[model samples]
Target chain A: MASNTQDAAHGAAESAPGMPQLDFSTFGNQIFWLAIALVAIYLILSRVALPRIAAVLAERQGTITNDLAAAEDLKAKAVEAEDAYNKALADARAEAQRIAAETRAEIQVGLDEAIAKADEQIAAKAAESEKAIGEIKAGALESVKVVAADTAEALVTALGGKADAKAVAAAVADRMKG
Target chain B: MEGDIAQLGQFIGAGLAAIGSGAAAIGVGHVAGNFLAGALRNPSAAAGQTATLFIGIAFAEALGIFSFLVALLLMFAV
Candidate 1:
């Protein structure tokens, strides 16, 4: 059997003119196997692997879109928050300004009232002082007149002249009138 | 022998065809490297450009596969 196989192999090597792949006898087998493998691969890819890959790709795309949408939503929320914060800050400033203005107005009113009250007290005190000065002056004038009459009567009697009380009183009265 | 010389020629031709496949590999590398560089620079646009990158790779790989086919044809068919 080995010798026969060797002879057959030797005959094949002598008869074959070119590469084995070009041999017409094996062409059908090679072509058949190649077609089968190619078709099988095509079927597996189209029916199974490709659809799975496409599903994964779609899922990835959906995830990316969702993430982008979420990011956009977050950004809008942040912008709204910033706007609200700014509005609140502005409102707080306005309120503070209003309070400051109100406080300033109240202080101004109180200052004006205090100044008016002080002025009224000063005017009353000045009037009271003026009336006291007028009374002191009138009392001083009456005492001076009485002392002058008594001095004139004493002088007339000491001079050894006719010292009549009625006459001295009349003379002192006329001098005091002038 | 003439047959021995022909077989040597076929092998040598196949080896030479392999060089073309190697050159196609360099082209594929260039395409892929450039795509990676561009993608890294603009990550936000990377998704939009991924299909184009894959197409470029496939075209470059097709040339390599053609060279491989030529090598196989040289070694076996012709």
Candidate 2:
């Protein structure tokens, strides 16, 4: 078995001087080229590509924070607006109530003034009517006294009795008094 | 006859080295597929993970290149 392996190794070594890449003379060149390529790739990625990516990430973060802050500001503004509206509504209600009370007081004063004027007019009319009634009653009583004196004098003369006018008038005045 | 046997041995060794290259291909595929899956799930974080994905690809591809080199060496070198 050992002889067979040796034969195989010898034959393979003799065949075409083996792989050119495996040649010791070219190893240094291959290693140098590989190192150059790796370094170039590393430098390009770390310095250029990686920094740009980092910048984009930072920019996106800034935009998100700004948007959130703006939203918070808008929320605060909305709350303030609601509070202002509520205050205005309350003020309007109070003003309306004040106007209503003022209007009610003015109306009540006008009604009282009107009622007092009407009562004064009615009292003046009643006093004038009572004075007229008293004057009519006095005139009627004087007419009745004169009519009774004339009737008594006429009755005595028709009976052919002597009726003095002065005596008859005095008797009528005394009877009226009784 | 000895020369023929040696050539046959070299060819067989080269073929065996090709298996290593194929395994490296599977490793690269795994790395890339996992990165894509993660990237799709969180697009905002995708950029952050890209460097790691490239590094994984580079390591896997290096293994494949080494395997190819080994295959070449087996076929031609002692």
Per TM-score, the best of the predicted structures is 1
Task: Go through the candidates in order and give each one's DockQ.
Answer: 0.19, 0.22
Flag clash pairs in model 1: none
lDDT scores of the candidates, listed in order = 0.81, 0.84
Write the residue-wise lDDT of candidate 2 on B1-78 in tens digits: 244576677778889998998999999999999999988999899999889999999999899989888887776675
- Listed per candidate, the RMSD to the true structure in angstroms reads 9.1, 11.7
**TM value for model 2:** 0.38
Q: Clashing residue pairs in candidate 2, if any?
A: none
Task: Categorize the docking of model 1.
Answer: incorrect
